[model samples]
Target: MERKKRHPQGSGPTFDQLSAFIAQLEAKGQNLDNPWLMTKILSKFTEDIQRQVLEEKVPSDDTRWNLRQQMHCLDMVLTQEEKIELQLPKRSEIKTLESSKKEYGKTKDIRNVKFCFYSDEKDHWSTHCPVFKDPKKNSQHLKNTNRCVGCGFRSHTLAECKSKGCQRCGKKHHTSTCFEAEASDFDRTKVKSDDARKKTASAGHNVVDGDEEDDPEAQESSTENSEENHTVLTAKHSATKRENQEGSNIFLLSGTLRTKHPHSDEFVQLTVLLDTGADRSFIEATLVHDLELPQQGSVLMKLCTFGNQKTTVKCMKTRLSIWDICGKQHDLNPYAYKDLTQGNVQGVLDIKDLMYINEKKIRLSSSAHGYIEPHQPRVIIGCDQLWQFIKFDEPQFTLPSGLLLIPTIIGYMVSGRKFQNGDIPELLDIHDTSLA
Candidate 1:
């Protein structure tokens, strides 16, 4: 009966455990090294591992491997596959939090909401304010105060704002402050607008139904982008090229991550960028090859660049164990790509901003990132596993210069735009990605 047992499903027994079991059977006077015994051992593997091993025809080959050789191959494949299986995120683990409608209803009356931005009273609406009555002054006020022209908040910009757009021009700005047309013609133009214009207005007004504040991590990048003063990079596959542009403040959260060496106990460290925008994590193929990381499987993925260009590529999947800020190890299974990004735009912060952060005793993951030469990140941790690394209890701080410092399991991640006296800085914040 014991000889008929099989490896359990899910994360099955380790290679050492199976080897010890076989050794125990041999100690009991069983001739387990024979072909028949080898076949039985192969059958004992979990369903998935068995199927993988059989795919290469090890058992059916004309010149079959001996029992020891068969065991070695099976063990090798089993180790790689099981590691990936264990690291893969479960469906339940990634589910978004339930809506906060009930919570909102309970606290709606006493929410202490601020309806106006310009007034010190905060009780009256901005429309009632004397200064907001002037369209030109209202527009200038929004820009100078770094407020969203649509929602009139400092949290997000007009381009990124999710609130309702202007009712007059259908643009992402307040209707009262719209300079596109006079107030007398507003009603006539809005009603007679083309279908495309109406569609744009409808799309701009559509907001996510549920409470967005429930996921603060998702809001971090948006807040950083809105506060920063930088230009947008719209070129296709621009990350592969070298960026020698001066005055560009390309800020992406990057730090050194560690994984255990496959052949030894020592840890291997590699620089990785944390991106909340990407749905799935990615690793550079060259780094995987250099590290001798065993490939578990392959995935066919269509990668869409910043300029809306799409390319389908086959990505190899592998498991990695990375250590966080508190020295806790996390297992991640990431898809491997030929390349991710090569541009490293330094000079992110000026002297005054640095001094302010230092005075506040703020922690940063990679303060010297600006001083370093161009480097391609070996890994990019996307939204799929990004929340696992974020530290929610620790409050995030925004510098007077508009850069946000976010706390993570790895360390503090610096984000946002920096301004210099030269020409406008063109930055690449690769956010539009979908995994099909």
Candidate 2:
């Protein structure tokens, strides 16, 4: 007896059966509108036929078989329209990759493949293989054999490795250039230890010994000696120290000459000081007459104070020869006053009136001989005029060393009269209440 074949339930058509049927149709080159094949296939698969009708249009025998084969391989059951929706390549069609390679090798047309040239015009050229261009496309490729995978140079690839040049020095070697290498490894701990030792040594040396009253006589003598030493040290180190006092008083002496009124030819120079404390600079009447300086006719000026007391006096413009300690000279136009009673001086110099005045830091001290009386030659230099030439250190109140001392000729207003009596009435009144 012959064995009977069994059909699996719900089992769709197998891919091999569909593929074979499609292959035969393709070989015969059937057209898409064949109704005979469509009816035969649809009747065999009723459910699939309905699904195909709803989803897609009917296809030729070749397309239908091709889609059925793919669907069966994917474990899918398709309707008649789905089978018809499948499209198959013509028998005369060529493979894309193979055609691309052939066109690239024959014409070197970059559009035929994925490669592009790195030129200004951005010309695209194809490669025989995706990995390598054909030798016929460019002579450079033939000469170099192949391109470098690492750097894209035709001479060598990474697999046929060659020496890589140093990027820093442009040398055909690794980064071993003398100028590019690290100088030395830094040892922060060693640096810190050295600094600590120096600080400790300085602190130890600065420690003072003994109390202030340990030796009364000895201390007195030491104090005197220290004072002398200080003077000597200051004088010695003064040359190296820069003048930084912004408001230091500056004094200049003008050469003297014979006056017509005095009738005696006594060479005298006007002494002028830049007084930042006072609003203006002043000169003694004696010096002004002796110097025979140019004088502009007098004008009335009012002098006042915070107390609102005012005094009117005549001011005259005068040109005086001024000389600095640095040996520089200037012709200063300063105001002179008619009333000497207002101030002990002949004129008060106001720095703001000066045309081109240069200021400098000067050091003044009381003379040990006491030849000059106190308040006799007292001069006040204001801060506004002085600030332009120097900078000050508050703690020292002295100028730093090495700053240039420039000579400037400035025009200034000299107060015609002194401040009114009530300007500072407190100075005039002395109270006996303290004694009582």
Candidate 3:
């Protein structure tokens, strides 16, 4: 037969009874074989005593409560110790702060604490504390009042002065001035210096001549060598001048365009001047319609002052053949005009669209001297396109004919004028019929 387990009764023992039981168990040397079993026994006995005390309404001693309090105190101490261990740094930051304070001569603690006190007293105080002086109030902050060496202004130093001017006129002047008084003074000084130098040189030369007279053959040979050298130098200078003149005659013309009309078989040839001064290119609407040009539709081009301006223009599909004086033809795309009147002439070419010059093209430079007149049949080509061709000799023009006579350095001229109207198609039809 198996033995039945005995169950313990409720409300069995008080704190005093439990203590006495533990004491008796220790005195008999009857130690618990298993620690878990002893713990379970102690728990059961405590629960039973608590239930009994609650039912009897009896007050117990504070030993059990004191033990629990001790346990809580021990748990709190352990937690505090763990937190302190975690906060401990491998290397202290306070040492770094102290080193910085020594280098900058400013304490971080003072800065932080001073701000706190200052903030509290700000409403009552009219000025900052004397100890809290601004770092920017040093002598370096105060600018020097010395005048500039060049311009005589009080805000700058002597090295920056630029006060050079004409001594007599008090006007701004350069070293290369053409004033009569300055020229006269310079010439007089130069003449006097030259006279002195010549006298000294002549005395030296007299001594040298005397020495050379003793050796007549050497003197004659040196004179002959100097003459030969002079002749060679003159010939070389003349050759260089001729080469420069030849190079000046070359010029280039680029960005020519041709377009065909949509309705007719005719085409219009055009070229852009590439001038920023002139606003837009000029083309007749009738001429565009007459030529069967391709239209890429309209685009919004920004005006100088106005915003979002729209213009109706066509894009020419085929490249134009630009012919030079040498009869060479270049292929170029055509750009339509926005306005015809602002151009001031019959047809205005655009400067922007013209880009890239071939090796064979002529070059012309921009100049103000070239004149444009309403009476003359002359076309006022803008400076932008002209600059690419020939460099101007002067800024202002003295003669109108000078512009027409100026020759291009290098470029081909168109052999003949492009066929306008319906001439080419009519001739083609005649040829076809004759062949049939």
**Candidate 3 C-alpha error for residue 221, in Å:** 84
lDDT of each model, Cα atoms only? 0.61, 0.33, 0.31
Worst ten in a row by lDDT for model 3: 228-237
Residues 1-436, candidate 3, lDDT per residue (tens digit)? Answer: 1101111446345334544666686689865334454344335433533243333323544434333332233334334444665698634676765766552213332222322122235333212434323322211222232323223234445354344543444554311221433345677889876776566466421211111122344344444333111100000001124324332211112223333444563543343332222322223344445454345333222222113222212222222233443455443333344232221111111122122112223333221112111111111122323443342552322111111223332222111112333444221110000000
Which candidate do you rate higher for TM-score, 2 or 3?
A: 2
Lowest summed lDDT over 10 consecutive residues: which window, candidate 2? 231-240
Report the Cα lDDT for residue 115, model 3. Answer: 26
Candidate 1 — which pairs collide?
Answer: none
- Rank by TM-score, descending? 1, 2, 3
Rank candidates by lDDT, best first. Answer: 1, 2, 3
Error of 3 at 140 (Å): 40
Query: Which scores greater on lDDT, model 1 or model 2?
Result: 1
TM-score of each: 0.41, 0.23, 0.21
Candidate 2 residues lying further than 4 Å off, grouped into runs, are 1-274, 306-308, 338-373, 378-436
How much lDDT does candidate 3 score? 0.31
